[model samples]
Target chain A: MSENQSILVIGADPAGLQASKDIAEFGFRVVLVEKRDELGGAPIRWKYHTLAPDFVPTEKVLGPLIDFVKNNKLVIIYSSSIVDSYEQKDDYFKVRILNLKNKSVSYEKVSAIIIATGFEHFNASLDPRYGYGINPNVIGINELEIMLSNGKIVRHDGKIPKRIGFILCVGSRDKATNQWCCTVCCGISIKQAIEIKKILPDAQIYVIYMDIRTIGLWEKLYWKSMEEYHINYIRGRVGENTGQEKNYWLKEKIRLLEDLLKLCLI
Target chain B: MSENQSILVIGADPAGLQASKDIAEFGFRVVLVEKRDELGGAPIRWKYHTLAPDFVPTEKVLGPLIDFVKNNKLVIIYSSSIVDSYEQKDDYFKVRILNLKNKSVSYEKVSAIIIATGFEHFNASLDPRYGYGINPNVIGINELEIMLSNGKIVRHDGKIPKRIGFILCVGSRDKATNQWCCTVCCGISIKQAIEIKKILPDAQIYVIYMDIRTIGLWEKLYWKSMEEYHINYIRGRVGENTGQEKNYWLKEKIRLLEDLLKLCLI
Candidate 1:
């Protein structure tokens, strides 16, 4: 890692920020490329119950990274788009990026590429049973992020939902699909339940999770939410939707939880 | 709500802390009382996420409350234990409290008694799935709370566990028993995660929550934990324990989350 050598970071989420931090710490000229003007990315805006208090806004939590960028005079390309093109420049990998809004293309020399694009949600439209595309309010956790940022928790109908149900492992950890626990829904559900209670102390919240994956220091978070907050948790998987309401899904999908305790509770 | 009538408050938790400030502003004598030796109560032992950035401790967070206590000479009872209960001759609630280690009991009179003792945990033994009593290492969030106050993430084995599982909604939101969310878990969990992560960046963390409850302003903490520290949250419950590890479960109870993810990921 040479100070004169340039390093390219592909994504601009928490992972990318971390990578930039690691590389910049080694005295390398770094170029942080994000497709959005906002460097904070998903975690900054994505809606969910679980958030890290230390994970403040980009300008705040990412202060060290920003300072390193300023001190090193690193180039940041916001609103930049990248293509999977292989350019042979001195027998090295040369990636090309196009600025979508300006319609201008830029090229950069890279000594090493840190692929920290982070995870993505597979199409919810594919699973029509959830009524995602058919229902207005049937949105993923990411869509809820911006609204939550503004301290807004009400649905589009402007009604503070008395009963909120969450379906976890929606696209993750299913052998039929991309089998991986997005590893977040459980924590998000608890976080949301807590937040909802904060706003509407009387509201009822339900979390339907196949499993709650909270390990390490986070186990305490899971236990505290469950034992202290009083948010209900059912061990089960939600199935297809049945009906629709005023622009939103009137009926949530159904599925039988393998656990007898869950079935009896719900 | 009268200016001339001096108001009295008990328990310097959030409610008492808030009430003391509000009433004092109205030009009245506000006597805020705390049974504990400290002002912030359990929160002082518990690392909180919604604290000021100066790394302010729980006692310091009540700086305003403490100031009011000092300026107005608010009523404070340290090492005092509530003993005999009764009513006053003047119709106000009269109570007797014995100061521990001093071998003396004191009696006091008050116009009103605000039970701001906050909500205590239902206990770890209540949830057998967590292996609370069956296993010596499986402690509740409060146990970790004490250790965290000192700013270290140590395990029962005297070394950080490669993997620690967080089982959410243990006693509060059990679908079979209680359906109510305690409401503070998400924020507290986020705080613990960040603090633990800061101390042990090498540890693999997981938070298995039935749901996440960050509620309003605290949602920031939830997202920060998930996005920044790579704290993995799996939506699942604590399964049967049959392991014999002296730390996670026991010799015959259950094997805590596999101790590989944390090591392999980094």
Candidate 2:
């Protein structure tokens, strides 16, 4: 096919990859560009263990799509590349694609351009109250995903957490940080909770949240975590993760209650 | 345009309407079919007051789309109609359209067919434990949406309820009812909670759920309901809503606690 018949698809994410493939299948060349060195988007880059709602392995969902886009003869993938500039002509678009790796520039004309740049995960360290950067224990959900994928749920000290606590809406739904809610975090957190439960059955898990927003079919994750896994859901926002040795009294009271219950059972 | 060049779009909902409009814009005649008499789908049929997450008015979203599809000259609408039969030819499909209202039949041939038939709301009455059909006070989220749109949050006796309890996952995420989670309910319930709070400031709202799966940007609704409206979220499942007077002891205890708190404050 001629250059004018090519479709420029930015961001080699799942959407972009699928778009490129579909357009290519329709007897059109696709110029697929990605800022990252990789082809698959977040699921590949972040190494997502399992997707929420169904908890299907990330590889299982995105593997074939990525492979298809990568191997498609019609799809010209430009990894570590970005669209430097584009000029809309009468019929086609005059585009300048830049390679970030070796500082190379390629100019091409395409009939249409599809922008599929997926979202960037919110920086958890932005909110100091969560003690994300300060406290070693307070890692973001992204890091947790990696851990789950690695088959290890451990604290900064490399110790298995006995009582794990998930603080939801860390940077989301906060006027101070981001006014908008990071919708998937709730589901992701629940998914992680269930995973953690599966790994460490005896480990007590508590999800402190304003609301557990596992919307739609992802509601299964929330339900499963609650009913099957017995993960505790607390309705409240975290004021701050001081990481201080405070609330000893509450711990002591719980211990006493546990002791009393154990004696009664005996 | 010839009949073979036209495209058939099933269900004149938002998706179908949009699809029809787009196909028509591409210089192709679109035959839009709807089971209902109306052009707009669920939002119009259910008289939905406001959509969740953003809480945008239903009309504000679907009204224009419906009007556009209704006015589009290239689009032919068959309301109260069903595709009786369709035979796939070499390059086109011979379709028999039946209109329920007039018992009329129309024959058409289209090159492409777009099936955009949306989902049906789960029947809450199927689960007898919720007392949906038996109890007038126990209504589903659909009924709640209508009530919210009508600007009246009341029981059967037309009295404002002092204590409103929203039981989430009534027919959803239940092994006995539906094993699959009805994802939108969590967000919808939270939206309703906020709406009810706006109408009844003094009413104590409790959302009983296994998990409040208000996933994604809709997390804002959950946050808003909890932070602004102070809606109580109880983490548990309801076995049965017998509508019996067996909870008098708990009510008495709450009353006594309130009295004690009042005395302490005084």
Candidate 3:
């Protein structure tokens, strides 16, 4: 194939890998690039145990796609690489790809480019109110996923949490933090809640939220967490984490006092 | 260039239209088929006033897209058409296209086919507990969107709703109705609630839901509905809509009696 007929796909995430594979399957030469040394994106990098709604193993879903793209003859992958510069020409793109490891640069001419750089996990530490970095027990959903994936739902001190509370919209749905809702957090929390319940049935799990935004079929996780698992859903946002016995205190205007009182009593 | 190089795109919804446009832009001949006589899919067909989350006019988002696909020279549109039969050949598939309107059959060999038929609005009437069809006051979100878009937020009697209650997850996230959560309903309800509050500021809006699944950025709608619009959210699955005085009664397992009692008092 000619260099002008090649397609440059940036990022090695699930989306990028799938796009590259699909394009390569259409008999087009695909130049796939990943900034990191690894191919799989956030899911592989973050060590995501299972996906939301279904809780299917992350590898089970993304493994085959990643492997296919990595092994495909038509797909030429460059790890630790970044798109240094690009200019749109008459019918093709003049591109320069820089390899971070070897400090080498390669030039390529491609007809089209697909940028599929996925999102970054919201840094919970940015909003100090949650005490994510300060409090050892207070961990983000990403950390919790790793713990759950490893079959260890223990605190930093290696203690099983009897009363667990998931503070939703940590860095999301807040004018102070991020005005956008981290949509998957609700579903992830609920999925983790159900997983935790399966492991520790007697443990009480509560999800504190301004609104539970588990959109789409993932609503099953929300429903299952409530009905089957008996996980409690509180309709309020947590103001601050005082870290008193690793319990989250409510704001001034509490909506569900009964549940809060139950939490306090526990 | 050749007959086998042409791409067949089924459905003329936003996804299909966009797909056809993108493919045609890539210099591939695209056969765009729509079951309806007119293109532009559900949003246009349903007369959707505004989309959810942002509440942008449906036409504003889909208008340009439909127009581009229709006017594109590389795209050949077949309205009121269906793929009767398709057989995989050596390098392409021989597809028989049947036009329902003209009762004409056309054969084409296409290298690729994309099916982008969007979803159908859940028939709220399926679940009789909601009293959707029986009670004139009970209307689905689809109808509500059209009403809100028409700039009329009135009941069947053409009276402004003073105390409006949005029963969410009507045909979604229910064991009897649909096991999957109609993700958009929560955001749509919140959007409509805000729109209604804008028109009728004195109107009190309440969202009755098992779980508010407004995932991601749509969480803003949920927050705005509560904080700005003063729309109340009650946590519980509505058992039955007993349309007494055009009001809904709660189930035996009422979690928020305060809100329900407040409703009763109102």
Candidate 4:
């Protein structure tokens, strides 16, 4: 909370940008570093279009934060830079940042160090069963988002898909990739489903999920998607994804509740 | 539960039709009566374009219920009929239904009676201050819905409104009218806002509310309306409604949260 003291924040994404701004507002200097050339994180840089659950404009939501970070005199932003070295020197953190743009390294002693490195979307190409990279029709959620924002939500043959299928838990919540559930996926998928319906009103959307984790107040979104959007939902993970000439086929595993011991019949 | 017993369902709306069909499926004869000459309720009959929160087609939602009620042998529908009289006879009730289509009265002895008379929209005409009948621009939520469904959401002069405003808690949640929050209004308004945005992407929509009562999952609808749809929400009640040649003016009473005892500054 002093002018002399400063906080070193790594990764100038949404979290990093927001934290630096908040700390600067509290009368502390902040040095925000980003490996990328710009301050906007993967979401903005990659053009994610809209935010999940609400589907508000991504720019509108992040505009104020971006503005605050830019205008704040106490916060210094290091674009195209990475932390070269970091050492704990008693109460202070001695850190060296390498600026890729200038080809020079700078040392800074800060009172506190904060790491706000953002996350990466699971590569759908790793899972061959989904035919992500192989098939032109099959795409990851992040890719679909970028496509939607760019008005490219079409099949490989440049035609609006009559029926679009969203396979939930592509990488997350799987034994092979991530064993944890990406809680935001359900809301994101629901939001995307609504967005798709808005663009292609006649298109039928089906979501195949292990379990919809849009719990609590977010459950309303899932229900709305079902009742209002008329989205079809099947409680099972898709097994095989095959790309034909025009249509993409998804083989779903139908499991019966009564036959708990029996394997799923695809 | 037996074929000999009968259940009387008042009002042949969605609830009545579905209930009668459900009861008839359980081997009980159901007599569904409506004063209006329609099987679908006010919502269906009035043709609300899309159901709130999710924006699903209303016809798709109510189609199955209407189909079941019409096809079921045990479910007898009496359109243009009303409950004339009722009397409890031991365990059964003798009810008289007057047919509006024909000048005749029919009596039925039923084991159980269900009152499924749906709600009505608050008459905006009664509140002269809001200029319901005076101003064509200022309309009730139900009227807006009918207009939206009919593709008549344009101005009275047949021009797209660049700015549209909604005054929440119209009649239901007031001391002068019905003393209960018409909970569906919030979601309905939210849905209407989104629908309007879809049609007129450049149009600015604002909702002036005393308090947004979009509780639980319905809150997601409110958030979507705010964040995704970019609908503006002002936390206050409009006191005056003045319609000019083109623009409709709303006088809002802004209250400070700190001043609990102090009156709202209009």
Give the per-prediction TM-score of chain B. Answer: 0.73, 0.84, 0.89, 0.88
- Native-referenced Cα lDDT, model 2: 0.73
In candidate 3, stretches whose alpha carbon ends up further than 4 angstroms from where it belongs are A1-3, A51-73, A99-104, A157-163, A197-204, A220-234, A245-247, A250-266, B1-4, B52-74, B88-91, B96-106, B145-150, B194-204, B216-241, B249-266
Model 2, B122-197: lDDT tens per residue?
Answer: 7776776656677777776767787888888877877777777776776665577777765677777787788877
For model 4, what is the alpha-carbon lDDT of residue B220? 74
> After superposition on all CA atoms, what RMSD does each candidate show versus the true structure?
18.7, 7.8, 5.7, 28.4
Poorest 10 consecutive residues of model 3 chain A by lDDT?
A: A257-266
The lowest-lDDT stretch of 10 consecutive residues in candidate 2 chain A is A257-266
Say which candidate scores most in TM-score: 3
* Minimal lDDT window, size 10, model 1 chain A: A257-266
Query: Between which residue pairs do clashes occur in model 3?
Result: A183-B216, A216-B183
Candidate 1: stretches off by over 4 Å: A1-266, B31-33, B45-56, B74-112, B133-136, B175-179, B245-266
Clashing pairs in 4: A56-B228, A228-B56
For this target, which candidate reaches the highest lDDT against the unseen true structure?
3
Q: lDDT per residue, candidate 3, B1-266, as tens digits?
A: 34338999999998998999888877889998888898888778888888877879999989898889878888999999999899999888899999998899999878989999876777766777767678777776667777777787787777776778777766665577677765666777788788978888988777777766666677667777787879987777677766665445667465322111111100
lDDT of 4 at B137: 62
Report clashes for each candidate as comma-separated counts. Answer: 66, 7, 2, 2
Q: Write the per-residue lDDT of candidate 2 for residues A1-266, one digit (tens) a residue.
A: 34338899999887898898888777788999999998888778888898876889988878888888888898898999999999999989999999998999999889888999976677777766656666676666667778888888887767777777776666665677777666777777787789988888998877776666555667667777888999986556555554565221121132111100000000
User: Which scores greater on TM-score, model 1 or model 3?
Assistant: 3
lDDT of 4 by residue, A1-266 (tens): 24679999999788898898889886888999999887768778767879866778888877888888889899888889999989999889899999998989988889888899976777777777767777666776777787778865687778667777777778764568765655677778888888878888887787777656564456677778987999987656566654444333335445212100001110
